[model samples]
Target: MSTLLPISAKTPAGRPRGDGAETAQGLTPAQMARRMAGLEGLVWLDSSRPGEGALSMLTALPCEVLAGRMDTDWQRVEEELEAGQKAGLAGGLFGWAGFDGRFVLGVFPHALVYDHDRRCWFDSGGLAARIPAVAAAAAGSVPRLDFSPQVRREDFLSQVRRAQELIAAGDIYQVNLAHSWQAAWPRGADALSAYQRLRRVSPAPHAAFLDLAGVTVLSASPELFLKMSGREIMTRPIKGTRPRFPGDPARDAASLSALLASEKERAELLMITDLERNDLGRVCEYGSVRVDGLWEVESFAQVFHLVSTVGGLLRPEVSHAAAFRACFPGGSITGAPKKRAMEIIQELEAAPRGLYTGAVGYFGFDGESRWSIAIRTAVREGERVTFHAGSGIVADSVPELEWEETLHKAAGLLAAWSLPR
Candidate 1:
């Protein structure tokens, strides 16, 4: 644990603060990670407190890479990792994982960790000592980005009607239907600047920005998929949503109130909570899985959400990999009666979700992990940038209202990039 002392020397009027006193070049940790070599990375936990937020930048990779395309490969990695005589690995591993990737891509990086309380950088390795003299990455003026839908509005509405019919037939209680909106990636689009704008416009606790290879993931998600510390595993699933209007406190409060009071929304949330509890039960000790909170209304930059926390103690025989596999592609996004809902979603949704509904976070070597449901995210590859948003459709859901909800959820991101809704 090597700590860098805070630079407190004050500067003259209008001058920049001394090193260590100033925050890193307004770069979203992921942008900072990309400048480094090997498998270096960053994990930033969106927090409200100015200095209390968690941010980690990895500057060194322990090895090249270890990617697995299937569950068995990951399971084998878990077994081999646990069997390794690496003592501090108990702290965990650091990297990223996705919901639809054929492979779970990851790496072990030496990191520089910082938070508000600490107020200084702590490096697990000597990497941070060599801070670079890089110019501030400029995003210039925010440009309006327009999006085209993969699934037409009428088509999405028809899909919603079909889902309701399925519910009527007792095939499933609810299903999540989504549409991908795509736009041409602006030439030299600075994802870091986009993320900063996103934070300013729609800050969220689970916001993340990652540039894995050339595929950049920009997220301002307000939902937590899973978090584990030692034997305790926790998940906060978000199911219901209502958008917040800019500068309209009265309307926002009413929206929040409506979301909380709606029986349909409550029912939707409870169904997912039950699904999560069951998911946790698969890897947790018998009778240990429980719903810690139900139907809690959390307000965010863009919307109000009905969130619930489900937690459990991991069975001694269950590895973290097992627990994650059993619970992921989180039930909230997939809907109730998970497998059947997914089948319906696949059949109806125009395309595979790819990385949109994935999970992103670091699994520390200390047996601690935190990942967010990759909602409210943008994926940029080459000349294209795409975003996806969806709403859970229940028997009582109106197709038009559900379609509008997706727009509401995407409003902040669109606004951050100056895109039309």
Candidate 2:
């Protein structure tokens, strides 16, 4: 929507081959595997030609689905659908698209859609049996890394102070702060292997490295941006953050617990809850907006987080894109008074935030979905890889500690590149 780069795994044809390796060409993975095989992993589907959805290219296959009709309000369409199931969503999207439209959708079941208990995935490429085929192509190829680093730390802080001054004058309650990172790489080694390497050295339950258009968003985040079901919209914005135990268990616990009890953290969390509720209220049924849950803690390999879940029923008039537009680039990742915080972030954080602080997930027709904020992550392009991480800054925020928090946040990706997590 911002005239940004494409967000799909499929490589475009006629686009000059960097390597002679034949880029796989056909209908998307799901369309090709219409029968006998099950689709899996973070299935991503988008158009080579922008804006329009794929029609005849898909729907040639049979499946269950849910979707957000471009013309229909999202709340009305996805009344009770799971956020990730793509079959139903594919059907819904194509069904709404009718006979001729260029809209191409992606269907992803799960990494373990075929076998959830086992950590292994069913690579349609026969990654198990024919690993050599795809593996052989691995050479000097690379992946592009992207981010929005904090521009001038002091200048950014000055903007935060300005916001605080405005707050003192009574403009708003809070604002979110952030930084970004980005890089690009050529494909060589296996992406899965890289991920496995990370798991081996630094185990994490919620880390992910999703690729779209050769741009991989590698992350080790414990934060869930939002999940939707039927009329219920649930978003858990992680507010306060603290790194994993750095030798001193007592200090780590104290740090986490202090965040739990800190007035600044509590206020920060509340502002997001309010922002989320308002965002949901846009598409939700008039009376459906409500905070079903409150402040709670979710633990991860590197940090502990303060989170809260809020839910609401969608009104019949909202469309899926409408819902996204109502809440794009997550408020928690941004700041309160969302727009203003974003403006300040652009000025403070040096680089442009490609997809670092952005949300990633599957948009389906079945009405079900789950998206996570890309934090604790790294980006890789060619031989170069980098990680981006940052913390919120309020009048009470300590710059030194905030800087430490960013390093802590970046630990996972940095670790991927043989650096710190």
Candidate 3:
């Protein structure tokens, strides 16, 4: 996989130029592998637990880094959405040489450094340009993991019930619950193929995978982290969810409407919104936190969702890292009453989320950038493939409905697996 992506250093240095957003290249699996040749990078895929230190540890790695960012020009995004545009402008954040603080990217669909001569990927020692690929990993490797699948579901849920008890005793309104899957893949399978196949079933606005350090951060995320272009930074956190029906659209729409109107759904959305507002408040100029849109229901192939967009202006000197730090592990994917919910979810769920609910993206070393929450992804190593799907289980959340929601989230990966639909 690393051979195709040749990381070739420029013989003569010139000012790095910017390229606008590039769509995922419709290439074959072999093509993707060939692209990962000789390159050095450190990729980190982590669920949004602010305390976890993965992002911080990633930035401090001893290698050139490129991060994806979308917190730029929120105004332009609206225009594009209203106009029915297929995409928007984006860039890469890089840290190189003596220019340690900035990076450059021109909205390429996928970026990488290839061997100068072979035009293939460069993995060995050599100076090369930096690039970002919405999809990446050695031939078949995936993010490293320390999985605990034997945990009992009942025990996990009991922990969550305990947390709910705690929330009731406090002023917290809602929380999101989750489970994770963890394993390691070293040049094992094709991630982009999996992503393209997954999109056929569950397409989302935000998705990415990073191969950095010694691990590959795999993600098929559905949530947006933080996006920055110039002074504008925006986050669209997905809070409420309903499962998809295999039978009819009318029935699905009805279910979706119920989700849209449900009190539990609204509470979950509000919890994340409040969390995001606080995050933005950290770096945003005072009075910049605003809910541009809220409780907007968007439909995927398998389900309906209540998603909200919140944003703020970055303080003139504030760095993108600070903005993300304020709202790591996006509020939507994580249960509300944030900290307590995570504790409950972790304790209740049987599997480790690994890169499941974690953020996958690039940050701009050149200017501003964006990050996407990893969800609906499948991990492949050797002959085995593992994929996960989950939903927020609130007080009113039905066990059946929540169970079905997990199926809905898994629809994309299942379809990607080519199981009989």
Best prediction by lDDT? 1
- Assess candidate 3 and give its TM-score to the true structure: 0.64
lDDT agreement of model 2 with the native: 0.50
RMSD value for candidate 1: 5.5
TM-score of each: 0.85, 0.66, 0.64
Query: Local error of candidate 2 at 267, Å?
Result: 1.2
Model 2 lDDT per residue over 240-345, tens place: 8877786888988897888778888888888888998888887888878888767788666667778888888877666564565467667787777777777766
User: Mind giving the per-residue lDDT tens digits that candidate 1 earns over 1-421?
Assistant: 1222222323223244434224443444544444442233333344421324454434344443455554556765575446531454322344455656444344543455555355444444334433453533434555457777788899999999999999999999988989988888788666666766777788877777665544667788888888887789999999889888659879878888888889999999999898898899889989999888999878787788989999999998776666777787899888878889989988999988877887877666556667888898888788888889999999999999999999998888877885554
Q: For candidate 2, give the lDDT of residue 171.
A: 51
Per-residue lDDT of candidate 3, residues 1-421 (tens digit)? 1112222332123433212012113322224433433334433222212222112112212323333333443233233222321232222332210001112221222333322223233221112223234334444432233333333456545645654575667634565555443334335445544444444445455534444433433455657777776678999888777776759878876887788788887877877888888878878899988999999887666667888899889998776655654566666766655666666556556655554565556554334456776566654445444556666756555555554566567556555444242
Worst 10 residues of 1 by lDDT: 1-10
TM-score order of candidates, best first?
A: 1, 2, 3
Which lDDT values do the candidates have, in the order given? 0.70, 0.50, 0.50
Q: Predict model 3's lDDT versus the native.
A: 0.50
Runs in model 1 deviating more than 4 A are 1-62, 76-85, 89-92, 133-144, 419-421
